[model samples]
Target: MSQAITFKNRVWENAGLLLFPDNFDEKKTYPAIISIHPIGSCKEQTSSNVYGKALAAAGFVVLAIDAAFQGESGGEPRFIEDPYERVEDIRCAVDYLVTLPYVEENRIGILGICGGGAYALNAAMTERRLKAVVSITGVNFGRLLRDGFAGGTPVESLEAVAKQRTAEARGAALFVNNMLPASVEDGKKAGIEDIDVLEATDYYKTPRGRQPNGATSVLFSRLSTGLGWDAFHLAEVLLTQPILVVVGDKPGGFGAYRDGFEIVRRAKSEKKELLAVKGQSHYDLYDKPEAVSQALEKAIPFFREHL
Candidate 1:
């Protein structure tokens, strides 16, 4: 059974759903995993809930949470996606898990999707309490936003974004990214034919995977700050826990992770693996049954052995 729950301010007051295995025994402790959502996404998204429930069904307690300042979580200046704060949110979730008598504090693990995957790695870099980590279609948002997805955007636009940040600091309204074109015609007019962005659009803008609070738009100031972050920051040394990175075999499908698998490779952990799903796109793994099943096949045993 899954139950809605809240954790008081350790980093932020976070709202999430906790899933328990069937025939759960509260008197006994169980291994637990934290399911983190993608950038601009919430716990209600498919990545969080789908994996959370699956991990629960696999005999582990799972907690899927909205990041600080997003979804049901409380924070100031809403919708700002800060990578540092997100790493802290994962750590705070760990703090909450340790307090639950039914959770094995020493057996905690984490699974992150898209940008959340990077943040999870950042958390695992320092949070030794996390025994294992899993990243699916992981993206270092800072690099992607600055360099552009598959280098789709001109590098000159980064300098433009920097200028916009100065204007915002001078009392201008927050500059936000125009994620969707005004219409399909507008998208065509702008030549926004990138397959990755198009697939993401279909998933978030249409009923295929839409949620009320899941906005594709992001504050430019957030991007400016995020650009300075390296999800693999000091990872080669600090990241000793086992990690599993899952990506799509289809080219242009997994975005940065396709080529950036090298970043995850930098981890010093002896038991890390990068598993690519054959014929699947990054977004396909979001809710597609076959793709998700293939992912869990590797993930379950990785955690089973490590956690």
Candidate 2:
């Protein structure tokens, strides 16, 4: 069963869905996992519906959260998608988890799916309390948005985004952005040919993965915030915790496949491992039973041995 909860982070309160093992006992401390949701997603989605529930059933206390500025959480200038704030949110989630007497403070692990996967890796670099980390179909979001897999966006584009930021600072309304196309057909009509993005439309725009509190809108100024951000920066020296990155061979248009491999290549952790699932696309791992099972099969043991 899941419980609705809220916790403080700076000036805002983040909403979360907490799950405990079916046989949870108050007398014993249990290993915990923080399952972070993807961009534009809330705790009710895959973060809880897929990984959160599964990990909890596997004897872990899982906490899946809705990031500030979106979902049911509290923050101003909503839908910011600021990567630094996202990292801070993960750290705050850790703060909340450690307060529970039934949670093993030193035995905590973190799991991030899709865009959240990037934030998890970034947060783990300095947050040593998180003993282990997992990134499922992880995307170094800032890098992906800046590079777009082929070549980086021009500096002029960043200048334009900065200009828009200045306009917003001058009291202009925040620029609104739709995170996804209305449907798969609209995505195709808009010239999106990547299998991962189209499948994302299928998931987020349809009943398959949609949630009542979920939304596809975000502030356009996030482009300026993440223009030069790199979630994996400094990971080579500071990311000493055990980490597991899972990616599908078919990265499709999003290119998280490359990001996953690069993280493993640069991480200093001796316990790092990368699981490349054959033939699966990025979205395939979101809710597909066969793909999710393959990931958990490896992830559970990795967390078991490390946490």
lDDT by candidate, in order shown: 0.81, 0.87
Backbone clash total for model 2 is 0
Candidate 2: clashing pairs of residues: none
- For 260-300, candidate 2 gives per-residue lDDT tens digits of 99999999998899999988888888999989999999999
The reply for model 2, stretches above 4 Å from the true place, is 148-154
The sequence of per-residue lDDT tens digits that candidate 1 reaches over residues 1-307 is: 9888888755458888899999999999999999999888888887556888889899999999988878888886678788888988888889899999999999999999988888888899889999999988788877776576322363455576677778988999886664665445556678877656767777787787788777765676556567667788788889889899988877563364553487567999888899888898888888889889998999999999999
Clashes of each: 0, 0
Model 1 steric clash total: 0
For every model shown, what is its TM-score relative to the native structure?
0.91, 0.96
